[model samples]
Target: MAIDVGIIQDVETLLKNLNGYELLSYAICNEECGAETYEWLAGRVEGILVDEFRYLAKEKRKHAAELRKLFEELYPGMKPLEFNAPPLDTLPVCRELMKTKELENALAIAMLSETIGRDIYRKLQRMSGDEEVAELFKRLAEMKEAAYEKLLKLYEAMEK
Candidate 1:
């Protein structure tokens, strides 16, 4: 598919406008959505894939918790944002992959989502003026890259 430069620019503008708390809240929501998606997948897939999904689910939740902690520290008494709706636009793509109940589809979605996430985090890191927030975003981008590589490896293995 062709890259949507317009959409990318729109998202960049949105990210640039977000304050520290808003950025952290957005990250937390994305992590929670990811955790929920993986947990749902874990219940559907069997054998080794189930275990892998469960691990991914756990890691996603951990990411959410870490982001929440940071948000709390930054905004002492404020409540963290709730995951009441789809966090990111790609979340529906994940839901579609889950509905398909196909390992290949799930793996493909994971790879795509991770790449998008990494890019977003990199952009956020660069746009952030706060050193701590920038560092956190950089770390998140690195983690997303690692996850993307893992998903790509799994997808390739399944193709063979």
Candidate 2:
């Protein structure tokens, strides 16, 4: 129930220090996880909500592909550092959302996850020294923002 500001700060610090390859590696993993989560949610929901979740899953996969292409371009011939442990799975909210049967709760948690992602991309954009990398992050953040808006609309419509 209680959120630890300290852990959040520590994670931010860790992300800030990561090299381009490392950051992208984590990002790729995150996108893959998001797609999988969305697909899982789609299976649990009914009616139009299923389509919305599938759409989100497809978008996530697209983002992952774009990130992977960028990663390959930036670090030609070098493999992205393998992410042994994905931090997204460890997030309390993500864990809780996975177990939740309530559609409203799932939607809220998904929106929150997207918000966190957008914020992270914005932060990375600000911190990156490379112009190309920064621009890519900015674009990714914008895309995430769009996805968040769609999720917000869905949430509002469900509430009506």
Candidate 3:
């Protein structure tokens, strides 16, 4: 459950340097990609894990919607950036772990992804010039942290 401080700091620095529009675009793309990933994972997992994966997928979609709403409100006529395909390297390992029914490995991958996402949102929240946008990022970061914590707990229980 412990994320590397160096990675977090690096990501934070990168996010903080973005302008408001760039930050919003980044958030939209990140949320959409996360939603797609979780949905795909849900279909691939089996048994009791299926329900949990589905729930996470639903949550990710909701996160995307929330970000979209905020983006629209902030920049009324501006179109949000479309989600680019995530890196090919990104979820294949998790898919392999799931295929082998390696629950702990799959959950570890998910937890790490969520931790990085949380740190990005946390940085955005701190550096955002607009109060409302900053608040939204704070909430988004909290959601990511909650998801990571849930996965970590499940991983620990599985290990036991």
Clashing pairs for predicted structure model 2, backbone only? none
Cα error of candidate 1 at position 19, Å: 0.8
Q: Highest lDDT: which candidate?
A: 2
Output the lDDT of residue 124, model 1.
Answer: 82
Predictions ranked by lDDT, top down?
A: 2, 1, 3
lDDT of 3 by residue, 92-135 (tens): 34444345445565677777777767766777888889898899
| Model 1 misplacement above 4 A | 1-12
The estimated TM-scores of all candidates read 0.83, 0.87, 0.78
Q: Please, what is the whole-model Cα lDDT of each candidate in the order they appear?
A: 0.76, 0.78, 0.71
Maximum-TM-score candidate: 2
Candidate 2's residue-wise lDDT over 1-160, tens digit each? 2334565577788888998788888878877877887898899877767888899889889988998899889999987776655445235365666677888877887777777778878888888777888898899889888988998998999999
* Candidate 3: segments with Cα more than 4 A from true spot: 1-17, 83-101
Q: Write the per-residue lDDT of candidate 1 for residues 1-160, one digit (tens) a residue.
A: 2334565566667768888777788889888887887787778776667887788778888888888888888899998655465445354354466466677776777677778878888988988777888898899889889888887888888889
What is the model-wide C-alpha lDDT for candidate 3?
0.71
